[model samples]
Target: MAHSPSRVFAAVSPSAGDVYRDENQSVFNRGRKQTHLSAQSNVRVIEVTGCAEVSSPPDRACVSISVKNSKENVNDVTNSVTRRLEYILQTARQHDVKEENITVTKHLQRDEDLFHMQAEVLVVFLDFEKMQQARTVLIEKLDKSVCVGDPYYSHSAESLSLLRRRVCLEAVDNARLKASEACCILGQALGRPLLVREEESREWSSSQQDTSGSPLTLHPRTDPTLISASSRMFVTFELRPKDNNRRKF
Candidate 1:
């Protein structure tokens, strides 16, 4: 992380500004139009693989709570779980959870003289703070018959799409930055990128955030509160001699 990219010509290069650029999708700084270059043997080129990763706290979560009870009569068991189910639904409403994001399931069974009934309610939340509050309220209100599962966190569909695209752009910019530094060392001027392609892409999620106050252990173990995306890009750029400044092809 300490290896800073040497800004040889970042001001004039594609890697100068924010990595998440959409105003103009073109990677290059648009001071001049890019011209096609021939693939002749004389044309010198450099190839590099650029990798980038991005992560953000989850924007969505789901909380599930289940209640069950046994009674001498079927109606009594049903009423027991239904009352708690209605309370759960009401709690979800009070917390501003949308109707479409709430789900409820019920089950009833009888054996011998004992009647058993169970009901589960699932609520989806867009705000983490609100989710925590809701979970707390449910635990405080419900009795031993109720079970509340841990909140499941993840990014929304639109958020994941945007994150993937942004990481790809960052990878391209990284490649350009690395190649530019290499050109400076070899005493050559960097030219337009000739080819760019994504070599690989991966995404994964973990269970929970780190509690030890230390960095993540290794690959596949990311922050529990976040979803992440990474991309590796292969790029080929043109190289030019310092003397031929005006000859652009």
Candidate 2:
């Protein structure tokens, strides 16, 4: 074996021409290690807005009536107002108006030469037909001393509260529907809702406002004291690919 020492360091291994540099960025990613895609956009979202409006007619009316007269003596004036006061109450009860819904106030004073007696009746009516009937009875049976004022119409607290909540929910539903449609057009799937914001909310009567917050034009057949509520909402929704699986890039 010592006869050929030059062959000991011979060209048996690979030369520089035979060796090559690795083209991969990370050499550790080779061999048994598997490559993975990076997690991009953990949360992708789209924002949209929606609007809604609700309306209800006034459910109650307050009718006012006044009785006033002057006589030579305090007893005579008092008697006169008393007779009209009883008539007013009787008329309301005949029309099925509740006792608790009726109020009576009386006043008496001395003028220069006579006693002046005055009384007023306030009644709240839930049924418009009953209110009209009661009004007609008072106007027909009472003397000229009795004066009936116009009815005041309005909404109850409970009704207004329910209306506000309903309008807001409708607005939110509209927002979700709008977002879903947008995702569909964009070739994506709509995911869970991320957030909701009630941008604007307001309520007013037809006697006060319209769509632009101005005076509303009343229809002859519609209620003039109609109540209306409007709601505007903004919502954010997650957007995902129709196929919700990841792919190697």
Candidate 3:
């Protein structure tokens, strides 16, 4: 009653062909993986800079002094600015502002024909109660002498300052947010991020700078209000972009 082996069943089975197909598929997958790895760049990576603008009371103030004398008397203007500078020095000393704190930035003529002179002084600490009082007194006294017979007190004073750290910190935070946003956009394009970089330090605006340090290269979108600690401030930072494997190659 048992059937012969040949008559029992005769069905075709894929053996070497199927094995070869599977092996080829595996080889293709391996090749793809290797290609992807080879295409990846090994460029050094750094994080996008983060900046926060914070608000804090300014620690100091700066002011500029201008004096002009006409009637072809350049000497008059020079003498006038000098006298006023000396007076400012005296008043600063009286207010406990160190003598070194008062500096005259320029003592030159504005034009060869017209008698004009410019002077500048930095009020180290306008927040100081004494310095504030001194400022008012010095202004009044200078108005009488430096501004005398100059027609409507031509001399003008302005308040300038460095941005408070709190505000700067806020700016840093804002900058970080911007950097993150940029990264998000870049991530969608370049795949993903692998690194970021940021800087930590006090930066000064052109107006706030003194006779020290390299000048800061300002960013256009810099929050002027935030940068202005007392009156004005400026800062700088750099951004870095990277790629991450987030998309199908």
lDDT of each: 0.68, 0.67, 0.39
Best by lDDT: 1
Q: Can you tell me which runs of candidate 1 are displaced by over 4 Å?
A: 1-38, 41-44, 154-160, 182-191, 202-229, 239-249
In model 2, which residue pairs have backbone atoms overlapping below 3 Å?
A: none
- lDDT-based ranking: 1, 2, 3
- Report the C-alpha displacement of residue 248, candidate 3, in angstroms: 54
Give per-residue CA lDDT, model 1, range 42-74, as digits (tens).
355656677887775677778889999999988
Error of 1 at 31 (Å): 34
lDDT for position 71 in model 2? 95
Greater lDDT among 2 and 3 belongs to 2
1 or 3, which is superior by TM-score?
1
Candidates in order, TM-scores: namely 0.65, 0.68, 0.34
Off by over 4 Å in 2: 1-41, 186-189, 208-223, 240-249
Off by over 4 Å in 3: 1-56, 110-113, 144-249
For model 2, the run of ten residues with the poorest summed lDDT: 1-10
